[model samples]
Target: MRCLYCHAVIHEEMSWSDLLFKRIEDPFCGICKSGLLEIKKENSCSVCSGKMEGSGTCGDCLIWNEHQMYHDVLHSNRSLYEYNQLLKEMIKRFKYNGDYAVAGCFRKKIIEEVKKLPRQTLLVPVPVSEERLQTRGFNQTEALLVMAGLKFECLLTRKNEEVSQAKKLKHDRHSGENPFKAIQQLNGENILLMDDLYTTGTTIRRAAHILKEAGAGEVRSLTIGR
Candidate 1:
């Protein structure tokens, strides 16, 4: 096999488990794999999974928890990887440049995490605006879930085409009118929002607020990056 990211040959020293049982293997070769940094849950914020200097909440989560409106709107978030330079470049190429094959690099991790969520939890992929969907030729968030072979609901819709979340500053992200609207009334169901990135986490928090107001029981998130 070959590295999914760099297309380099992957050499393996087979262990007995490989012959005896079905064991998942790393998709990328050592050099490429080294570039992907996973967040250590023990040293991360309990709410948003941001890296912590100690064993408590990070400053960003602290601010969100303190906000009267935003507090508890998003129950929690679990990010699989840190937004390192290598992942950034891969995301740029996959999301913006239309290199769909790059999605394979993240498939293993996404599948592993989804399997860990409660069986009854509703999986929802954060929707892109119609304009963005047209421009990009695919909703990247939806594509991530689809590529992982996981089922998700289109529960929310982007109300308008405005500035892309990537272009917005922290203040701008917090100031925007709630762009998401629930497609159907939820009945206190546990929800897990799926997205590609979590910066200040303004995006998912807004989505969670809409879902919570519509009666979702617990609104948490699973993001590929933090």
Candidate 2:
């Protein structure tokens, strides 16, 4: 195969990261990783851009008192992709197939999205329950963060294993009160919360509220897919 940036011939034997990292480490490869790839962004509503802003919930959110529910919250969030078939399959393979090797494929994209934020932003991966952690052996979100060269800390804990958020309706998922609890103080810091998928934004919002109450100066969210 050819290097995506340089068009130089690349060996198939080496994994994606090995090939990309080699090019990144090679000074002569002018078309190094930086310019070879970039994350894609789109213009849409800051909160849930599923439809036109004037159409429905967008306008309601503007005047809603829900904003007060989260302290130290700078802005609501956005996501990269709609939770369609392609994304669903990819996430399934990543989560259940033990395909950690493919994580680097997302590195460039994740870094691109993250670069739009402040450099001092600290990444916080949504925590999984102890039972889930023991079964999966690793949190895919954390792995993605490491692959993206971002610093992350597991600060929140899931109180219970509720129904899979993916299987529930958005309203049903967010209908329940926050289910996460912060065990540590964030202490007036900037944070970029991450998760594998954004089904209802319930988990992320709950985690964000916890951090804000702990004195986070600003809180934003990013997910692999929405």
Candidate 3:
């Protein structure tokens, strides 16, 4: 196989089996598999689906606070992929199909995004309710952070087990009634809020509000898909 990005010839080889019952070399190539790994590009806004012009924040995002009440404290947010067919499928499989291994693919993209920001920023992933955690065995946002080798704390909490926000319409997704509470104080801290996707600004806005109320110095968000 040839690498899509570099067009390198990937050599194949076999490895010994670990099981005691039997042993056989498998047909796989280390170089090709590594090369074929998907690379995520810094594309556009997940919330408004606008083009990102190296500002990290989109033009539509500049007016997000006008529609929402939390503008006074929230600083900005960023996402790596447009929430289109490819991203939707990737998120679905990561969330429901038990394809946890793919989290590393997003991890690479998100880490690149964070690197573009100033160093030493604290990462705060949106918290999943205990009920959902029990069923899913992991929070997809947290998994992405772990894979990215970023530092973060679980300071925010879901107020209740609300309906799957993913299925809601964009306007409904931002309705003010959905509440996120801060269980801990992050006073004077710069934070990077992380999530799986950004359909609307509601969830991140709620989180930014609570973080600012808790004395967070600056609040920005990062997600896998728009």
* Top lDDT prediction, candidate number: 1
> Sorted by TM-score, highest first, which candidate order results?
1, 2, 3
Model 2 per-residue lDDT tens digits across residues 105-207:
5676677678788878888888877767777778787888887677787777886575766678867866776778887886677888888876555677778
Clashing pairs in 1: none
Model 2, position 71, has a per-residue lDDT of 33
lDDT of each: 0.88, 0.65, 0.68
Clash count in backbone of candidate 3 = 1
Q: Write the per-residue lDDT of candidate 1 for residues 167-222, one digit (tens) a residue.
A: 98889888868899999998989999999999988899999999998999998899
Error of 1 at 189 (Å): 1.5
Using Cα atoms with residue i matched to residue i, what is each candidate's TM-score against the true structure?
Answer: 0.94, 0.73, 0.72
Please give the lDDT score for candidate 2: 0.65
Best first by lDDT, ranked: 1, 3, 2
**Candidate no. 3 TM-score:** 0.72
- Kindly list the per-residue Cα lDDT of model 3 for residues 85-157, writing each as its tens digit: 6556667777888777667655556766788776677888898878788878898989988876787888888
Candidate 1 segments exceeding 4 Å error:
19-21
Candidate 1 positional error at 57, Å: 1.5
Q: List the residue pairs that clash in candidate 3.
A: 46-226
- Root-mean-square deviation of each candidate, in angstroms? 1.5, 6.8, 8.1
